[model samples]
Target: MAGHSKWANIQHRKGRQDAKRGKIFTKLIKEITVAAKMGGGDASTNPRLRLAIEKAKGQSLPKDNIDNAIKRGTGQLEGVVYEEVRYEGYGIGGAAVMVDCLTDNKTRTVADVRHAFNKNGGNMGAEGSVAFQFKHCGQMIFAPGTDEARLMDAAIEAGAEDVVTNDDGSIEVITPPNDLATVLEGLEAAGFKAEFAEVVQKPLNESVIGGDDAMKMQKLLDALESLDDVQEVYTSAVIDE
Candidate 1:
């Protein structure tokens, strides 16, 4: 349950993602559109679309934007097609990094990611290189006001594995990969509101970094995440700074 402790590491990444609200809107819009196109627009009926809409709501994205995005996905409006891409690499301190992207151009996306890594003191690794350092899991962030004991009790019942507080005062709930959606549904049924919920890669062991290496690592991660094609960036560099 505790091979890594990159709490501060991820909070910083999330802040940067939020900073580009327009891009965030674009990403979420694409996700909602794709989900609705594939599974129909009813949030109650399509889990993927529901999650996409919920994520947009958490970001306070306009309802019109959300609707338009859904339309584009369903072909009522024009939209570019996107493909899912993954890149693994090493950041400062030799920590493993994983970036998930949604892009229309594979070649350009790869080149952009490589350039970002090189410019910021990192090297994108070959396929399956850094990826093996992590495992997939379902993760959710809960509001700060939840009763810890009650939450722990409920989560355990719903197959959750652990709950930890982030450096910025948020709470992260982890569950087995297969149990992620189930646990989240249970939590929601029980009246708990989560800010962000998704299945993601969790690093097994962290690279303890400090000083200049830490700064470099932060910069590299930030650069990778800022790319429009990049949807998520994960690393195992546990930095206290």
Candidate 2:
């Protein structure tokens, strides 16, 4: 495998996330509430809700908070209704960018997203402008030292779509979006706990970015992710470590 270090990218994203732990919880709560609202509160029956709950628990969100969020989503408790919106754009070096948001007010979210893009030397694009460069799928990334042989066997047995080893030796398991939970469970059962796993808009290809372009890209991503309405930001730019 010859590309950016998957491990490094995971670490960079994790570092950014760790710095925003407070806001992370808010984002997780919103995801859970929205997932429940759309698919009912039963995690077993709703894969989206199940994944959201898992993510929230992984972040150590309180049980009471999770329960309340579910209740609110199910309309047992009143809460602001949110709608999912995705904005696509271009980042530094022409890297494709996608911003996923859970917003009660689409107008505010779009303005905030566009402002962030414009301010950071990027441009907000029309729907599907950059989305074509990505694929919606389940992605699980293992650390560099994980056993590739065993991982391959387990991933294949677990019905993974593809297994890729990055230049830095980190491994990635790809699965269908709807099969994420089942695949994750199988891999964990096989003792292959992932360092990072989620259903995401995975980049079909990456653009290696360094120098000032990388810095500007980070700024653009940070600005977008900092918005209260934004849930996730995806980019094809892989900053060199």
Model 2 residue runs over 4 Å out of place are none
Error of 1 at 60 (Å): 1.0
Give one digit per residue, the lDDT tens place, for model 1 in 1-241: 2423344555665787778888888788777877888888777777678778878888899999999888887788888887778998989867999999888899999999999999999999999998888878888876555676777778888889988765445577898765666788888887787766877897876677888898888888778878888888888887657
Compose the digit string of candidate 2's lDDT tens values, residues 195-228. 8989999988898998888888888999999999
Worst 10 residues of 1 by lDDT: 1-10
Question: Local error of candidate 2 at 185, Å?
Answer: 0.7
Off by over 4 Å in 1: 1-11, 37-40, 142-146, 159-171, 176-182, 188-196
Q: Against the hidden reference, what TM-scores do the models get?
A: 0.84, 0.98
Model 2 is weakest, by summed lDDT over 10 consecutive residues, at 1-10
Quote the lDDT for 163 in model 1: 86
